[model samples]
Target: MFGPFRLTSPLSGGLLWKIPWRMSRPQKARQRARLRHVDKVVSIVDQALAKKGTTTAAVERWKAEMPVEQEMLPRDKYTIFDRKEKKYRKGIHKLPKWTRVSQRLNPPGY
Candidate 1:
């Protein structure tokens, strides 16, 4: 465990891997699909609530505050604000759990 392999890893103060600065086209496509799936789930829930004569405030607030995937600009869809990054932005894919977490919004004028 003290040879070249471990020596070159995080335990030895070296990065084990690096995330790319940009997402590949296929990755972007998958990201889009995930966004669409989330949108679909929200819409379905809204419809269900409508039929039940009740709507949750959280869902209503989400619909009001968040843009649907189709409505987002390319910049918003692909990147997020990062105060430490050059130009104050970074690729969303670089975030941990990018596929599982919702990160569709950023502060205005960033």
Candidate 2:
């Protein structure tokens, strides 16, 4: 045994373990409700898709609600073209005005 020469992660401070969590009543109810809603929606979609010859009204409505893809500008420098906003927006090119330790947290090469 290599005494004190331990292979452990610095991120875990040489110790790592799982903490068992008990879900409260509200949390359990919320998860169940979300899962039930998703299951219902999926089943409806499957039924609509199963009938081959004629397209169901629900399928047509869903297709109409689907969003269309938009064109995007090449992301090289600062500004990016926002598809939803229909505008060019600024990104990582803003001037920093941090004092003391705050200045160190700026993105790499900034």
Candidate 3:
């Protein structure tokens, strides 16, 4: 004979079941913040793209014209990730160390 297994225990009640159903408060808050930031960035890019004919060349030109100090400018300004290897052909220019440091520390979305 198997021992009696009661479904309702004093310590394990509705609260125990509810715990899994509830989202972690901190995780939810972080997700909301990330969504907001992504939306803002998308809006800014969209606004910039909307001004002219919205062509690839126009976007590339606009990106190239941006200041190097700006976060968005480095990739385009330095052309480090360029597939054509035009700018960094001689390997004189390199990404700053701080970029890697920040990337490791902050990460994408917490």
Which candidate number maximizes lDDT? 1
Ranking by TM-score: 1, 2, 3
| Candidate 1: clashing pairs of residues | none
> In candidate 2, where is summed lDDT lowest over 10 consecutive residues?
97-106
* Each candidate: RMSD: 2.8, 19.3, 19.1
Clash pairs (backbone) in predicted model 2? none
Give the TM-score (vs. native) of candidate 2.
0.30
| lDDT (10s digit) by residue, model 2, range 52-88 | 5556776566446422111111221223233333333
Displacement of the residue 103 alpha carbon in candidate 3, Å: 22
Off by over 4 Å in 1: 2-7, 14-17
Residue 48 shift from truth in candidate 2, angstroms: 1.0
lDDT scores of the candidates, listed in order: 0.89, 0.37, 0.39
91: Cα error in model 3, Å: 46
Instruction: Give the C-alpha lDDT of model 1.
Output: 0.89
Q: Model 3 segments beyond 4 Å from truth?
A: 1-22, 55-110
Model 2 Cα shift for residue 90 (angstroms) = 43
CA error at residue 42 for candidate 2, angstroms: 0.8
